[model samples]
Target: MAFLEIDSLHKTFGANTALHHFDMKIERGEFITFLGPSGCGKTTVLRMIAGFEAPTRGTIRLDGRDVTHLRTRQRKVGMVFQAYALFPNMTVAENIGFGLKVAHRPQSEIKQRVDEMLQLIKLPHLGERYPWQLSGGQQQRVALARALAGKPQVLLLDEPLSALDAKIRISLRQDIRALQRELGITSIFVTHDQEEALSISDRIVVMNEGRVEQIGTPLEIYNYPRTRFVASFVGTLNILSGHVIDPSTGRMAVDGQELRTAQTLPVGDAGKKRMLALRPEAIVLEAPAAGRNTLTATVEEVSFLGAIVRIRTRVKDEVISLDIFNDPNRRLPERGQPVALGFSHENLLVLEEGVQG
Candidate 1:
């Protein structure tokens, strides 16, 4: 059996539904991420799992025991928020040992555990300082140490690094992942940032408008999105509208140009208009090769993003973006220059016609 399971979970506030039949199973020591934009129910799922919010309908099972209606204290789950919720009146050591103290652990044991936590977080010398004396990043580390000090069964982080600067956020996320792996704790992270989710998660659950769009590994979610929303939301995708000419051969027409795809169209989807998703890096600006789809386009704009060059080209009425590695020795095409774009059939994805916001 899975270590943790959320079955048929549903949450509603008044007339507004926050989550709709959300279900998931997490293995012991697995790292799962709930990735989505604001108001997409990702945070709602996290809160429900933490026992902070009661589900209108469902069951939460941990180690084969039902905990759906359990109180927050009974769940033994540790949570770290976006803002470091450190007690202003306490020292770092005191904050880390607060949970142990509340449970009436011996003073010597609490002191030993607090010192261990400070060493684990690499802030042993700062334990004597107060929260107000530390930087934002240091305060967040203290908060994380506090959450893990109790040795809870599960750890939940809700945008914990979103408040830190870019460099610190990157560094702290690496530390958090390493610590999670070392402790072998079942963890769930909630974040709207795609880069962070892709970098840290063992599996990603993409949610949209209170529903799950897709659930898979980072590579599967990025390279083989199952829905239009998943294609557009997970990464940078160029969606082109077209119609399938032959479902048996996977042929389609886009912007007055013919193209082949590796995907077999649905039985009744032939002759129907559909959307094709292609990544910016998939399009190549080079001479057309055999068995490749090629189109003539005019360069509309060029942007140099360190290590990569982004070129926006106008093909008929549609604009397609292409990314090429930056070569200091080679010259790039100027604006208004005509160029030929080529891409393989395998990179072209036939996605669902309707995309949810």
Candidate 2:
């Protein structure tokens, strides 16, 4: 049996629907992320799992026990919020021990658990400090420590690192993952940041408009997105219209240029206008070689983003982006300079032509 199961979950607030018929099964100790833009039901699902929001129509089972109607305190789940919901009046150690204290544990046991949690979060020296005295990252760690103090079966993180700076966010996320692994806890993280979800999660569930768009590992979602929403929302993609020439010969025309794809075309007749996707790294800003398709374009913009250089080029009427690793010895492309972009047929991804709300 799966460790956590959300079956046919549906949620609504008055006239509007927040989540629809969502279903997922997660194994024990696996890290899962609910990723999407705001109001896409990612948070709603997380709330339901944490027993904060009851589902309107489906049941939730954790460890094979039905928990759909349980209150937040009755469920064995710990949660950390994005706002660092630490009490201002309480000290760090007091905050961490609050959960244990509420359960009427012995004072000796509470102190021991509080000290252990402080050490685990590596803030043992600041136990006496209040939330207002701690740094943003430190306060968040205290929140995390407080959440874990109860030794809950599952930990739910609701965009915990969203408030920190980029460097601190990266560091804290690493710390959280390490701590989660060490404790072997089943966890669910909610985030709108694609890079965060891709980097930290064992699996990601992408949602939009109260519906799930795709669920897979980061590589699978990025490399072979099954839906147009998944393809466009996950990362930088070069989307364009492709006219089918001959399916048997694997021929197609994009931007008035002929190209070939090794992937099997969708069941369709000739002259079908299909949308195609390609990653920025797939195209090289150079002349085309054998077994590659070449597109003539003019450099429109060049952006040097620390470790990578993004070059935007105009081909016919469409703008395509290409990413290349930054090298000090190479010259940057100039605006209006004509260039050739080359890509192999297998690199092109065929996408269904539709809009996702």
Candidate 3:
């Protein structure tokens, strides 16, 4: 049996639909992320799992037991939100021990658990400090520690690192993943940040309009997105409108340029409409190459972005971006310089022509 299961869940707020028959299964000790933009129901799903928002339909199960109607306290699910939500009047140790205390645990047991939680979060000595005295990162850590104090069955994180700076967010995400692994806890993380979800999750569930669009490992979702929306929403993609031709020959035309793809093009010639999703970094710019995939473009703009140089080029009437590695020894092409764009057959991802807006 799966460690955590959300089956055909649905949620609505008056006239607005928040979730639509959403389903997910998380194995024991696995970290799954719900990734999407705002109003996509990532947070609504998390709230359902945390028992804060009851699902309008379906069941939530843990260890093969139904928990759909259980109250928040009865579900034994720990949660950390974007806001630290730490108690200002209580010390760090007191905050961590609050859950145990409310459970009617013995004084000695609460004290021991509090001490262990402080050490687990790497703030053993700062247990006496109030929330106002801690840094933003530290306060979030305290929030995490408090949630884990009682050793709940599952941990739900709702943009827990959204309040921290970039560097701190990265560091804290690593820490959270490490701790989750060490404890072998089933966890669900909700975030709009693609990089964060890709880096920290064992698998990601991409959502749109309260429905699951795609669920796969980070590499699968990023490299072989099944839909146009998933491909465009996940990362930087150069979308080219084209028509497929000759399924047996594996050939297509993009803006009058013939391209090769491993995928079988549409046969029977029913208009043969299709689209190609290409990554920016997959394109290689050269002076000229003897191939059909090469296109001459004029460099319109160049911008340095620390580790990479972003070059904008115009081909025909469309502006496309390419990222080149920064090298001190190499000379970059100046603005308005004509260049050739080349790409491999493997880099071209062909998908259905239609896409949802």
Candidate 4:
């Protein structure tokens, strides 16, 4: 049996729905992430798991026990908020031991746990420092320490690194992943940052407007997206509208040019419109080789990013962003330069065409 299960979880506020028929089975010690844009119900799922918000319908089972209607304190769960909700008056040690203190543990046990948590967070010397005396990263560390101080059954982090700067966010997110692995804790993280989700999650649940678009490992989510939303939202994809020439053979006509996909294509009319997803890195700016699809394009813009040169080009009405490795010896193409893009038929992805989540 799974360690935690969220079955048909639904939430609504007045006339607007926040989450819809969400279902997931999480094993023990697995790190899952709910990834989506703002107001996509990722945080709402986290809140439901944390027992801070009651679901309008469905059930949440933890370790074989249903805790959907339990109060926050009754459910053995720890939560770290985006904002460091540490008390200003309390010292770092006090904040770390707040949960233990609230549970009415012995003073001696509380002290021992506080000392252990301080060492766990690698801030043993800052025990006496107040929240105002610490930096943003330090304050977040204190918040994380407090959450783990009680040894809860599960840990929930609601955009814990959103408030930090880019450098600090990267560093702290790595630390959080390392800590989670060390403790072997079952955890759920909520974030809109695709890079962050791809880096740290054991499995990613991609949500869209209260519905789940796809759920899979980072590589699975990136390489084989099931829907149009999954393909475009998770990474940079060039959406090309084409007419199906041979649905069974996965052949399509784009800009009066021919291309094929290795994936399954629907059976329909020969001129039916279909959407295709192609990654930027899949195309090489070179002449067409044997058994390759070639697209003629004109360079519209060139962006010189670090370690990468992004060449933006257009083939008819479709715009494609191609990323190439930066080379000091090679001169870049100027705007309005004509170019030919080549890619394999296997790299062309067939996206589901219809209403997106």
lDDT (tens digit, per residue) of candidate 2 on 1-357:
899999899999999999989999999999999999999999999999998888999988989899999988888999999998888899999999999999999999999999999999999899999999999999999999999999999999999999999999999999999999999999999999999999989999999889988889999889888677888899999887888998776788988888887767755748998778889999997777888988889999999999999999998878899999999999888999999999988788778544233
How high is each candidate's TM-score?
0.97, 0.94, 0.93, 0.96
Number of backbone collisions per candidate? 0, 0, 0, 0
lDDT of 2 at 53: 88
Please provide, for model 4 over 159-267, each residue's C-alpha lDDT reduced to its tens digit, 9 standing for 90 to 100: 9999999999999999999999999999999999999999999999999889988889999999888789889899898888988899888888998988888866767
- The model with the greater TM-score, 2 or 4, is 4
lDDT of 3: 0.86
Give Cα-based local distance difference scores for all models: 0.92, 0.91, 0.86, 0.92
lDDT of 3 by residue, 97-178 (tens): 8888999999999999999989999998999999999999999999999899989999999999998999999999999999
For candidate 1, the clash count comes to 0
Model 4 residue 75 lDDT score: 88
Which 10 consecutive positions of candidate 4 have the poorest summed lDDT?
348-357
lDDT of the structure predicted as candidate 4: 0.92
lDDT per residue for candidate 1 within 90-153, as digits (tens), equals 9999999999999899999999999999999999899989999999999999999999999999
* Between candidates 3 and 4, the lDDT winner: 4
Sorted by TM-score (best first), the order is 1, 4, 2, 3
